[model samples]
Target: MTFLWRISETNADGLIGTYSRSNGLDRFELRRGKRIEVNEAMPTVRFDGRTRDLLAFDCLSNTAAPLVSQRMAQALRDSCAQDVQLVPARIEAADGVLDGWSLLNATATVRAINHRKSVYTMVPGTQAIMSFRHLEYLEGCLGEHQLARDAEYLGHLLVSDSLAQALSDFAGASFERPEEAYYETMSRRWNSANDAR
Candidate 1:
């Protein structure tokens, strides 16, 4: 499936890219009762991983939303029967730019009924978030290898200056320095919730 990146004015800066699943459907054609043409040239990223694939995109929110991270953590925890713990994760970016960024990582064993573990890492950017995730099933799973490769590819993209430049170029806006305090507060809340569980 091909993913299209479109710019929307949902944020104050009005330059945010949203990733959506495209089925090559044309709104105009459907309205006019015309034959829809499929354009295969659209940029598409194939995910080949053992588990669900993680996609990256710039959200329109002013700051990183805690609900997004919380939901992700909850999903990972729910996937396994054992209690899953999510703590601050250290990210060693090849470019070293992510050294000061807040990262969250978690891993949990699959339910007793299944064999394997689920792993996920999230890197929140000023206006975007990149997640690397995979499930280690017995005998391996389809898309696990692809997920790893995509995570690496996306990790580089997150730390690269070109990503910001591309966003600026496309949105006609500048990247705002992320509010570290906000993210820290969110992290504390998440950790506190984990502790209470």
Candidate 2:
């Protein structure tokens, strides 16, 4: 089974309803693909009305960092413990503090993108990747692994087929393979171009 996709989720209003990183979050440290030093205040997430009884898997609205329920975190740990760091995080809701959540921090990066087949570039002297017009992975670049991130785009999460299947039942969580996203992106652009006619 050769399936790959990034885990992305949005609420009914097209926003990441239940999950957002605190303003004080050190996003860079999470991107380093290593265990984060838990500060006095570990990484945290804020929840609002939309989160009531919602599924436990979520991603930070702006950064796309994953936040998972304890069960989801444990699933990852059992499958690919070496590829991820289950950093503790708090889920603060209006009524009270909800517990048993972890930030699914990726710790493995593979430069699996076949540059010639992919259209993307890194900003000068920075890790930020822009112009991801196309993406194509090289054969065998991603070996057997449950979760491996993209080297070019630190925020991008690539999950194996098994992992995707394991998380399939989670409500509000969505995953898309590269080609699926690419086709959708291109189709939208094409429709827009034609609509301008």
Candidate 3:
């Protein structure tokens, strides 16, 4: 999807050129919704401020096709000398065990615990409070699991490098799993409850 970035506003000193800055005072009063169409080429870079930074008078539109990520990497490299790499992945199936939230909740709980204990060592006096706060972010996942009683769940899908690493490491950690049948039933009930809404 193409993202359009229109100029909102700029510094009063005119360091950055925006829509209003480009226009000059004219004799004829230009009311709102006045048809200001361009018959010829428009002014490009107007260096008004001390910094002499190039600013535009009007909005610029750009279009792109599907090879967006590749183009983005090339643009970044062109702008700066930095190495860019991308990793892609796909899930073949859900394994027919856990519904979405069942697996996600388990994963998030494990992660929050590890983060609270290993990554960030909170003082015992504050550990309980911090842990609760951290767990709150995972509420959606927990609620989802509670709703999807018995369906097999699979997620923690890898979208980015950092997320993939976090999920893989989190999965390596352990948690107490209920008996298979009980877990399935609970998951189904929870999923049904949520779906009703």
> After superposition on all CA atoms, what RMSD does each candidate show versus the true structure?
19.9, 3.2, 24.3
Q: Write the per-residue lDDT of candidate 2 for residues 103-158, one digit (tens) a residue.
A: 77777777777778777667889766775777777766668667777776666677
CA error at residue 118 for candidate 2, angstroms: 1.3
User: In model 1, what is the error at residue 172, expressed in angstroms?
Assistant: 8.5
Residue 81, model 1: lDDT of 16
Winner on lDDT between 1 and 3 is: 1
Clashes per candidate, residues 3 or more apart or on different chains: 6, 0, 20
Per-candidate TM vs. native? 0.20, 0.80, 0.15
TM-score of 3: 0.15
Q: Which ranges in model 1 have alpha carbons more than 4 Å from their true place?
A: 1-149, 152-159, 169-185, 188-197
Ranking by lDDT: 2, 1, 3
State the lDDT at 150 in candidate 2.
Answer: 75
Instruction: Sort by TM-score, best first.
Output: 2, 1, 3
Model 1, 71-189: lDDT tens digits are: 34444344421322233212222222111111122111111101234343445554333432332222322121111111222211011133334334332123332233235456788
Q: Model 2: clashing residue pairs? A: none
Over 4 Å off, model 3: 1-10, 14-31, 50-197
User: Least accurate stretch of 10 residues (summed lDDT) in model 3?
Assistant: 97-106
